[model samples]
Target: MSEKKNTNHGPQKGGPMGGFGAPVEKAKDFKGTIKKLLSYFKPNLVKVILVFVMAICSTIFSIAGPKIMGKATTKLYEGVYGKIALAKLNTQKVSLEKIASMSKTPNPKVSGGLAAIKAGIAKVISETGGKIDFTYIGHILLMVIGLYLVSALFTFVQQYVMAGIAQNIVYDMREDLSTKLNKLPLKYYDSKTHGEILSRVTNDMDNISTTLQQSLTQLVSSVVTILGVIIMMLTISPILTLVAIVTLPICGIATSGFAKKSQKYFAGQQKAIGELNGHVEEIYTGHNIVRVFGREQESIEKFEKINDELYEVGWKAQFISGIVMPVMNFINNVGYVVICVVGGMFVIKKKIEIGDIQAFIQYSKQFTMPIVQTANIANILQSTVASAERVFELLEEVEEIAEDKQPKVIELPKGEVKFEHVKFGYKENVTLIEDMNLEAKPGQTVAIVGPTGAGKTTLVNLLMRFYEINDGRITVDGVDTREMTRADLRGMFGMVLQDTWLFNGTIRDNIAYGRDNATEEDIINAAKAAHADHFIRTLPEGYDTILNEEASNISQGQKQLLTIARAILANPRILILDEATSSVDTRTEIFIQKAMGNLMKGRTSFVIAHRLSTIRDADVILVMRNGSVIEQGNHDELMKKNGFYADLYNSQFSDGEDVG
Candidate 1:
């Protein structure tokens, strides 16, 4: 066996919620993860369907709006420039198609242009008697304005309904994730950091929320606009429609290339950011240690390195994604030029009207925009799917072993506990505690002491059922602990650890947390028992003094006192005190020890202490080494035996060796 030391190795690995900076590991089952994410949409299916429908309606009106407005432009052009100009032409040998062709040529129109115009005027006079339509122009203008207004209203309705659906889905996700966190095993969290878990819950959920709110609608609108614009353009002129479609293949190739590069950079950028944030967290959490050691320069140097890496990846990711716009814009301009030239030829031939040519140009612009927005939305969805992967990972984490189907409750008994033939280890193929046996009768105080990692806390963890034993059985009042529900077994004990925990709430609330529905009187009495009431009363708000987020306003000793008060309020049949007075001053230590003694009266207790003196008065002392009990006796009895316990005890006083 390896020699044991009084040290903790710290926590293990775990999972996340999504944000921009999560590491770039591909989830094990990508398709399965997406399927799980989609399952959440089941409850909101109706609302989601409504959102898509509204989106389609909104996009259709917006697409048609540009074409409708072209009517006004055509009317003004024909009334002021075309009809009156045509009235002056004479019908000899002229045609508008031939005139348009000659306008683009060098010098062919010099002699025939005047005679051709006279011929066109003669033709127009025969058709309309040299009159121009003015009343029809005004009516078309009103209709165009009304189309724009309706389009605006549909878009508003679509967005409003989508907002509610997206937010509600996000709410359900957070709620479900919270429940999953509670159900996860202790070791799962032991493996990961707080920031990682928070990212999966907050950042990832936000990604999903934003995607549902915006991307879904954008996706629907992009499709509707693309199709609607194609049909509109075809009606005006098939040649122009073909010109517009020709650029799509070029855009597609460019888009595919940029997307691959951008996604690669995006993943790298997120990973670098995660590493940088981790460095910041580590530096800040150990800021005091850093100051004491004067390692500020080294810390700063480390930060700079990480920051430089982040800048490299972040710049590349952004640059790659941004290139998509300029590339697509170039392709669209190429198509636009072709369409305008072809449409002009059709107009002169009288194969299509000037109004139709204007409408087709507007349709072309509207169509190109949806393609751009859709491509951008594709990138957004990639990041969102990354977020969903995180949420899925968290939801899929392994939970604690199932509770007994026919469960027993810890009821109607004295506080007697027993551990028999227990064997366990944190990792498989290495048993730290093997075939161990122990007992604590009703009202007896059992103190377990050992070097760190010798399974001192591990024993308490087994008793609390935070971890399961590899073999044998633990019992409370002669009933096997495994048979009893975990909730019931845990409910019988009240524990106080070395580190105190207090939330952002009043002093009274922190104390009252030990018991459900505890009244003010119950809180006050528990505080008095733990000797925390006097200082609490001295505060500005007495028991109502609010603790800040970190509870840093109070001293360490005061926080310990509050935790003791919380335990006192619980008043459980079994008590476990773990170095409860380790960090306090000697005077506060005395008060804590006294409160602990009072608290232990008539209750079965287990004390895990580093200070041997604190456990000297324990009913039984179980000395542990490498996960086995090497000595078992009261203080005086162990002193007489003069073995391992003697060295441990004498080390504390003989030469002032820090046995603790």
Candidate 2:
């Protein structure tokens, strides 16, 4: 397995940052969305509250720190402007004094007044250096530093809290989604692509996590910062603050305008991704078949086409979204220019002080900073919302069969099974099993035989309640099956499918899968009974050998036997053997058949057989044709009837293969 590296920059490796190309798609009902998102954090309300408070504090400090820096700049400039003003006044005084003294009869009044004013001006210039009160500059610097430190502390707290919340939310959502999947009606899977479903659970949820981790955090901080900055701006200069407010409309229009284009591309990208995943999944599972059929180039072409579509969507989305950040940055800079140029005139005219103008310039950024943050978070926001919708859609899917109003505990009495006038289909207005009826007594092995697509498997499906009957009912031990809980109903039967799916675990784990608490002795006995112990013993690791992905290390025949052993361990009251021996060779088939006979000794068994020789001794033979039972009786009775069953049996025997 390859290690997962951060691939945020690459197209194929979609990290949290990948979906920036897509803009926020217009989703109706913002209020409802907010409510739904909030519900995810309901359990951690205290943490959420604390995080919000911290965001507010952080915003206050962030806004205050910059304004304080501006204030210090303003103070320095005002002191220079004041000194220049005082020097000019003193120069005027000296010239007036010189003019008075030059008069033939010296005007003492003019001279004295000029001399006094000059003395005052000289004293002012001298005292400016000593007691000029520029020490406030140091205080302002400290204030800026203090605000920054406080903001940083609050930001740290907010980050840690929000991260914890986001992780917890993702964990809970995945666990809930998994549980819901297990409870979903089987037919939901039949009509849906596994890739699409997987995307919702994995990719979509991951998008939500990424959004929470970064964009959501920034969004909160931005709002708080904006609010705090606005308050400070209002306090500093109300008139200049009005000029700062104009930038908002421009930013909003720009963001919303670009977002529209981005969203369209994003939706397209998601669709393309789903299609790509579907194709990839199909190709991988059918790689061997593709090789046998020599369609490697064809598969590659299909993949390339899908990949190209994704690229187009991705490019368009990214291109549109990319403009937002730069554009917002530009607008923010323009807003700063406007504040500086316009506010400068006010300060020069003495309508506002230099400090007020400087503070207003910084506050303008505070006003536009939210817009910048929003632009940055836009991609994540869009993807997260889109992913959330998909996940909710899956959660809202209707189940195949509704649970009983009051389900009863199932108590099996001898394991007699009956299907009476049962009907089922994958969709409405179509029936796979119509008025089908069958009965199996305890310890009786009933074999159902038919050509492919004759609904032999459908019969087993109905018994398992994979689909609900449209017409009649199935019963276990004379009680209506629907009355029992689905889990309890399924617990009565053990099944071995044609295709066995194994998880990554040991051979012992696979065998014990049928019974959660199955003992070591039970596992070994089951394996021995299924005729799998001999082969298992010869293996280097025996029962301890681990399996990976469909038990690929083992042969198909071995997997089938392991399944059989699993069924034997479950020791269900009823059993379903669907092509149980199909994968095995002739030598293994005979031994497996004998082992199956032993397992079926005291269980009600339903066997769907392809080879006639395997079911020759079955108590009852059911011959089906196109979803209808054409003939049914004991093996001997069916042969005597000389109907579909008899013809099939004769054809099999006439072949070169001998049936002893």
Count backbone clashes in candidate 2: 4
The pairs that clash in candidate 2 are: 21-317, 21-318, 23-262, 23-263
lDDT of 1 by residue, 286-307 (tens): 8999999998998899889878
Reference-based lDDT, each prediction: 0.79, 0.79
Among all windows of 10 consecutive residues in model 2, the one with the lowest summed lDDT is: 1-10
Worst 10 residues of 1 by lDDT: 8-17
- TM-score per candidate, chains pooled: 0.85, 0.82
Q: Name model 1 segments beyond 4 Å from true.
A: 1-28, 86-135, 251-272, 305-324, 654-660
523 Cα displacement, candidate 2 (Å): 2.0
- Using TM-score as the measure, which candidate wins? 1
Q: What is the lDDT of residue 514 in candidate 2?
A: 88
Off by over 4 Å in 2: 1-50, 78-135, 160-179, 209-217, 234-285, 296-324, 327-331, 375-386, 399-413, 650-660
